[model samples]
Target: MAQISNISKQLQLKCSGERFYELFKNKMDSITQMFPKKLLSYKIVEGNGFAHGSVVHWKYELRGTLEAKQKLHMDDTNKAITLEFIEGDLFKDFEMVAVKGEVSDGGSNGISSVKWSVEFVKANEGVAPPHNYLQFALESTKGIEAYLCNNN
Candidate 1:
């Protein structure tokens, strides 16, 4: 098994915590919906969409024709949202996958920051981090951040 690897990034947004949270929630949903066929989409399979154990199912597109089921574990507490990739193509073939979000107090700056992180476990025991995985995460983050910033 590969060692657990972590990636973290923080971004400041010019919005209140409540406003920021609302936008962030919507943006997350929007991002999750960007799967192949739109058939494998995410819904509140349990409690409210913003609560723990709120399961989200989506399809991760592999190449052009391959796709696999991805089940997400949600934890919304302490102004943070945690998404654990409990079941997915990436997790099955690879090792582990998780994404987390936390909102920082704006303080006197009037700008709130969102701290995002992703942890990955490798498929092969000795290989380095894959370029494609990093690219995909970066692209996805940029896409959602751009959309949220532009629209909000």
Candidate 2:
């Protein structure tokens, strides 16, 4: 068995924490429209919306249009969402990959922050953890934050 490692990144947003949480809980597919260059499309493969056990398929431009599937578990009261990677190139070197995002007030009124974290187990001792993938998550969050700020 491989060791499980975890990493997290925090970002401040101009948008409200409620708005940020709503995006993940209800409007995730809209992200493809907000960042077309990075995300192509997202479809609900099973279940409905952001409910637990819902599986989503994603097509995104990451080193040439990679595709992945994830199962979502959302906590509306806590403003948190978790995604477990089910299949994709990301799993090539990772035995399991899970990402979680939590939204909270960012020190002052009208400002918010999101903490994105990833936990993964490498496929083998020689396999390295996914740093670039985590960067992708951070950049995507920033892009969504900008989109929300500009649209609102």
Candidate 3:
């Protein structure tokens, strides 16, 4: 049986939680524009947008120009979003990988935070879990926070 693992990270930002939630929940495609250095492009491969079951294709540079497809689910009331990897290099080592983000106030004026969690089933016990992916999410959140702060 595949081994399941989970990891989570929280990031505090000097931006509004509602704005961050809106961007993450609705303007995901625009993220490439905000972080062109890290993200090459993104498009909704299926569905109308950030709706449930929507497939999003992301092309980006990490070690190299890599692409991944994710199935998206969002809960507006809870300010949460989840993306399940449907296809990608990650799948080689993970039978399933779902990344979830929850946004909340950061206990200060104009400050917000996001909790990023990853749940994954390793393809085999021999395969090590991908922790770098969590770093990527944190870094991306920082970039987005900076972009929003500067642009606003």
Model 3 misplaced regions, further than 4 Å: 106-111
Model 3 lDDT tens row, 1-152 = 66568999898878888888888777777776777877887888899986778998988787778789999989888899998889987777789999899998655555678999999998878876667778888988988898888878
Worst 10 residues of 1 by lDDT: 65-74
Please give the ranking of all candidate structures by TM-score, highest first, separated by commas.
Answer: 2, 3, 1
Report the C-alpha displacement of residue 100, candidate 2, in angstroms. 1.1
Give the per-residue Cα lDDT of candidate 1 at 42: 49
Better of 1 and 2 by lDDT: 2
Question: 101 in model 3: Cα distance from truth in Å?
Answer: 0.9
- In the range 1-152, model 1's lDDT, one tens digit per residue, is 35788877777655555545554455556556543343244455555663456566554543533333333343345466666766655644567777766776586866777777777787776655544544555455455556556765
lDDT of every model, 2 decimals: 0.57, 0.84, 0.84
lDDT of 2: 0.84
